[model samples]
Target: MSVNALISNYFTTGALSDLPSDHFIDGVFVPSERGNRMESFDPGTATVFGDFAAGTAADVDHAVSSASAGFALWRDTPPARRCAILMEAARLMRAEADWLAVVESLDSGKTLTEAYGDIHGSARLFEYYAGAADKLDGRSVNLGNDNAAFTLREPVGVTAHIVPWNYPTSTLVRGIAPALAGGCSAVVKPAETTPYTALMIAELLIRAGVPAGVVNVVTGTGQEAGAPLVQDPRVRHVTFTGSVATGVGVMQAVAPNVTGLTLELGGKSPLVAFADADAEAVAEGALWAIFSNAGQICSAGSRLVIHRDLHAPVLELLVKKAKALTLGHGLRNTDMGAVNSERHLAAITAHVEHARSRGVEILCGGQATSDPETGKGWFFEPTILDGLSAQDPAIQQEIFGPVLGVQVFEDEEEALALANGTEFALAAGVYTKDIATALRMARRIDAGQVTVNDYWAGGIELPFGGNRKSGFGREKGLEGIDAYTRAKAITLAV
Candidate 1:
């Protein structure tokens, strides 16, 4: 679609036109009790695109009450029925993939291609969970001769999902699908920056015959809706994805309630390239790894640790690819889009400038950009910073932008040390042709997930999570459904 046509359609009649400007609760869309509502803006144009009700404490009370009421019936329903409903939801997601992709692209400032991948991944997650819903087994334990013991998995009554704006569609599904599969009612709070896709999915789940209060969506800022929802005593479990600081705050809020938590906090993930690796392939993967969503990813490969022999060749290839990337509005089929928000843009720009001030070499780009076609948007150049100490903020912090820091290591031990030097242990990747070297690095990387030859290689079947400050608990695969349930032991004596 043309840029002008996309702007006109989205501003007047598109996904925003079809969305309900209210919270979804008890099988219906209703206005929020709080009057302090905020409008969502297009990251590409900074245009006010849509508005929704701002939720409050009272709203959280009402939603939790509704979910509690629905829990009784939902938990009693057979697991096969739950699986069927989720399967239908997955079908609907594929049917509406195109529209949802466009909606995600405009709402979150990611390229259209990346948005499509997120929507597709959302469907895959639901489908995988649907198949596993009925497969959760409880083991039988042999006790005394007179007694028979067995265990059963039971759903935690209500769950709250606080998803981030980076990949709103996939992140929202990543939390809600497993809860539904485990027969638990959920109240989802999508990031204020990108709530449209969540609202759309809520409606789709309802249309697939989800029971009243089985799924609900509350839209508002963290201060208003998120805090009250997480702090609610009735909410049994909480899954959040965002910055580490905000994640700590969430943990504190849920501590009183002792709610179950699964957090995917941001990380300064490292990508290590060895002398035996393919320079061109690693460079391409590294570029896509860090810049695909304009570098707004929780596990982005922001830190690059390269072997000295391959450093110059890989750096050159990366710079060439970065310069070749085209930037514009997401709907215009560009390689990159806006930076989600002006505040985020400023933070990313500051990191680059900080590196420059400290006498670091910027191999490629290191500034903000405003194209004439998309005026007044938050955009930054794909940046590469070299010759920096390991303790530098650019190397240790989570920039969460299209900024990559390069470090040269003399040997394998030095490479492993550099990769494990950071406080984060969410994810890491190693590129090498030698199997022994790849396996050794993978085991010693000190990350929850280590991809051998590719970055972000795992799928929905594999458990994805982080360690240390990156947060805990697992999402995706069977572990995801297990997180929403608790085990109960039953014994019978003859």
Candidate 2:
């Protein structure tokens, strides 16, 4: 069916009967061992659309045991065969992109356009890692005569992926694809709020020739499903993407086991615009940087650090453009969509209210709103806070909403200070006409990824992760697979 047709069907009936609502274990859909279930809400409508299995510690144990066995079989599979299976999975994902996109939009409350991009990006991740499956080459060294030394890259056995709600499809795929490609079996614990897409993707992998038990998914709350999976000693690696608090918890859970870990955490990233930058372009970039996904992104450019000369003009343009943005259901393809949940909506409201109380100027929008037609969804206005100081909580902490805090700087040094003032160092953007200035800012910024002339510049080929409190390790690019594999030194005597 066409994308429009699918969307129309959803709004007409408010039900998607075929949506998977069971845990996927050993390559098949199964009920929770405890017969427990959890409801998933449609954030756009603030209504419960579906329910899925709420996995328990027993379920996690079952999935892990299945994965352990699967890992042994997959590890011995030829790399060429592994590449072929992953490539087929990518093809299947593309073939089903429209359906997956609609599901993602409904599940995550992102606009259909963004959901579509995420689905395609997920496919691209599979494709990228498929090509790398057979290329995990080791190195050879000459120790001396009659002796040879080399290194072997091998899979790290069973892996557990703890996925987040924001950017559900892409984030889940970002971690699992490389691990699967590297011959490791995965037991995914998708965020309880967004579990369908992960289960759907696992089904697609099975259809594309992945063996039973190689890819399993358990759905439930973090405490129930995620903790046990991470704490399991049999699981060799864990990749997590979420808030700093949760990442820390995952670290604590995995510490006893001393398992391999990769964390992509929260951010309060800045967008630094020099005086020479095009104000109009910088304004547009700012809109996309923070407002996309309803500003639920971890690496969102939530802080605007602009040169004093460009600050007024840039803020003016940003406020004007932000006001013009349309908010609605994800299926409607509006300029912006609802926040993920009512709880998140309340959090955003609290952030804005606290800022207002502290005398931060509300340059444009700073109120909680709802969908214009139904007036039911959890919506927040695209807000801009003007008189923010480095000490303000809004400037120092991650609001995780469509709220931008404006700060002015007199020179490059001041701009850098404002950009790096926050505890986060995930991502940043520099807008300037001068190459030297752009290069210098990129070098000096503490962020993991620094985009020049644009806010979200690079593709999946770029390594993405953070420094400091934003968490460690990396995802995407060639480095993405490194976390899932380990190196072993081999010596030969003749």
Candidate 3:
């Protein structure tokens, strides 16, 4: 679709067009509370996608109350039935892949390639969880002759989910799949900049035999809808995927309630290229690792710790490759795309500016502009920074854009130290030929997951998560189910 066409059609998007007439509650799509409450935007183009009646505190209360009312029925709902619904949801996701991809690309400033990958990944997550839905099991234990014991995993009831704008479609499903598979109902609050995809899911899940109240979305401010969603005593769990600060704030809201939490937060993950590695592949993978999806990933390899010997060559190649990346409208074929939101653009620009003011080298890109031939949109050069200490704010902090900070390391230990310096322990990469060193670095790196000799480092089944300030609990794997549930032990007299 052409830029003009997409813009023209944006206003006609009806994901939430009938919200006032169709409320999602208790397995039915009925009228939402009477109001023209909130609007959604296409962050890439700065256009209003559509509006929905913003769900109020009362609305949240209604959803949770409805979910709570359905818990016993849903939890006792045979696991096979739960699996079937999720399986159907996956089918619907596959059917709507194109639409969701377009919606994601429109809402987030990601290339169509990135957006397609996100929607595909979301479908895969739901499918994976569907395959595992009926696999939730308990174990019987023998307590020496006289006593018997067993353990069962039970759903934590209604869950509150909040997503960040970076990977809106994918993250929502990433949280939603496991919650549904565990027999828990979810009330999701998508990032304000990109809520349409959530509405898209609500639409599909409703069509896929999901009980309406089982998956409700309320679009509003975090303080308004988000806080209550988490604080509602009826909500037994809170799963948030966003920045460290926002994740912390949400946790604080649920603290008094002690809601179960699986907070997937941010990272300043590192990529270490030792001297023995393939220069070209590492350079390309390094660029892709960090700048993929314009470096908006929570596990973006934003820090580079290259060996002293290979630093110059690798740096030169990376600079050339990053500069060669074409940025423009996400719909058109481009190696890179625009910043997802203006706020994100500002955050990226601010980080780069602060780094430059403090004397860190501005290796490339810290500006935004438009292509006249095409419609106006946000674009940034894939940026790199050097000549800064490890503590330099540019290298230490997350810019959350297509910005990479280069810091050379004398040897393995220094590389590991520089990588571990950030409060985020989400992901790290080690490029080396020495198995001994790789194993040693693996033990030393302070991250939950480390990629060696490659940059294909994220997904649904890989137990993706972080430590320290990167937030806690795991997602995208069997552990995600564990994260969403509590283990119950039963014992008998010996």
List where candidate 2 sits over 4 angstroms from the true fold: none
Per residue, candidate 2 scores C-alpha lDDT tens digits across 1-494 of 89888988989888776899999999999999999999999999999989999999999999999999999899999999999999999999999999999999999999999998998889999999999999999999988688889999999999999999998899999999999889999999998889999999999999998899999999999989999999999999999999999999989989999999999999999999999999999999999999999999999999989888998888888999999999999999999998998888999999999888988899888999988989989889999999688888999989999999889899999899998898899999999999999999999999999999889999999999999999999999999999998999999887
Tens-digit per-residue lDDT, 1-494, candidate 3: 54445535653552322223233566654444645456665555556556655666876777787778766667877888888888888888877676777777877878888888888888888888988889888899876787889999888898888888888888899898998899888888877777778877887887887765778777767877788889888888888888888888887888898788888888998888889988997898889988888888988888888888998888889898988888776766477777777667777778877877778776777666553336666666788887568788887677888888888888777888887888889899988898988889988998889888886755678898899999889888888887667789999885
Question: Stretches of candidate 1 above 4 Å error?
Answer: 1-8, 11-15
RMSD of 2: 0.8
Which lDDT values do the candidates have, in the order given?
Answer: 0.88, 0.93, 0.79
Largest lDDT belongs to which candidate?
A: 2
Better of 2 and 3 by lDDT: 2
Best by TM-score: 2
Clashes of 3: 7
Q: What lDDT does candidate 2 reach at residue 129?
A: 95
The TM-score of predicted model 3 comes to 0.93
- Where is the poorest 10-residue window by lDDT in model 1? 11-20
Q: Quote the lDDT for 12 in model 1.
A: 59
Query: Model 2: clashing residue pairs?
Result: none
**TM-score (C-alpha) between model 2 and the true structure:** 0.99
TM-score for all models, in order of appearance: 0.97, 0.99, 0.93
